[model samples]
Target: LTRYDRMMARRRPKKGQAASKGYREAKKWRAKTYAKIARQRQDTGRKWAKKAVTDHDAIAVEDFRPKFLARSSMARKAADAAIGATKKALVEMGRKHGRDIRLVHPAHTTMDCASCGARTKHALPLSERTYTCTACKVVSPRDKNSARVMLVRAGLNPAGVEGVRPPGALLPEAA
Candidate 1:
């Protein structure tokens, strides 16, 4: 879609010729494409939000501002993720289902030790999938550890949370 938009931009009609056939066709196509993408994004957001609200008694998500993220270098990817739409859907679903939905501050949630409450001294890059806390020696997947942190920030005990599997525990495969 971006490439198409760029290509069409170079061939856009001059000023005072906005009613040209080519310009009309390009404008229509652009509008249609944008609408299609929006529909797909909305559908996906609603489905995941409904699933999350239905499956979990409580949910703790990062309080992220999509508009701020969209100003970064990863604007295109951020926009494609549709963070605002997903968050809106989640909030709506939570309200409808009477489920607890906490939006914790996103700062250092991924870097802080969930077990020790100490932020890691060194920067953890995206390539580092495993998070090993130096202060407490608690090791787990980065995502799992971040989630545990969020749970704690939301004033919940991570151990008491249902369906929280132990780190590195093996599960039986479905037959």
Candidate 2:
């Protein structure tokens, strides 16, 4: 991937009357490269999904929309991670295994703290991988904490709601 990035960065516009032909050729080559990389990513995802479905009875993941994130400056790396492809593969594998696959909404999963339900203006930086909850002092991995929040949003377990954990586990006044 680094090599590909360098190649693309070094690419120059073609000069003279044959420039259009050169441009077309370059476009075709880049398309081919993209297709190949996508195929490789899909294949790896299928393998991982197959293993996960075989090992676990139910799989839960966030239903993320990559198109919107792609428009953001800091999300291109995420867009390239093949999360959608992995989810699709997991769903297919779940069907084969007669298991359940769930995707929770992505809204508020990151911003809402899993512990203490404290929703503050602490938007995490993209480079930060750990989640540090200032309200409850419950620190955990960013992805795992986000996943827990997603589960709560999906109503998996009584997450401090009506008849749930004592008040303050959720419903954090947040954006």
Candidate 3:
């Protein structure tokens, strides 16, 4: 898309001027390219959503809203990730399949410790990939910790089918 966008920009016609043949072609190509990308994204999102709803009896969704990201530096990356579309697909699939889908609020999912439920005084920078809880001293990958937080917020045990917790075990969502 970026390549085609640059091509279109270079070929763009001046305001109130007749568009050249090259400019029209480039414009059409850019539109088609973007449309194709969107179609592909939608296809994949639906497929994955179907599989997820089929496999999981209950789901805890982060309920993340990526609209604000449009004005940020991460806009392109977030658009490529299709966070909103995938979420919508998952929810629709779950509803169609009669599965339980929980939408956990996104606030503080990154700063709050999944194990101890302690929030950091300052928000973690995007470059930082590790979450170290000051209160409980538990170190985990930032994404992993956030995922657990979602489960806990949705009242999930954070354990899978093979859940076998020993006495006094530290559960991921115990907090």
lDDT of 2 at 143: 80
Against the reference, the lDDT scores of all candidates come to 0.82, 0.70, 0.84
Q: How many clashes in candidate 3? A: 0
Candidate 2 lDDT over 137-167, as tens digits, reads 8888888677677767666652433233333
TM match of model 3 to true structure: 0.76
- TM-scores for the candidates: 0.82, 0.63, 0.76
Indicate whether candidate 1 or candidate 2 has the larger lDDT. 1
- Angstrom error of the Cα, residue 135, model 2: value is 3.9
- Against the true structure, whose TM-score is highest? 1
lDDT measured at residue 58 in model 1 versus the true structure, 0 to 100 = 86
Choose the strongest candidate by lDDT.
3
Error of 1 at 78 (Å): 4.7
Ranked candidates (TM-score, high to low): 1, 3, 2
**On residues 1-114, what C-alpha lDDT tens digit does candidate 3 reach at each position?**
677778878888899989989888888888998788778888889998987787678789888776555556545665746877799899999999999899999899999999
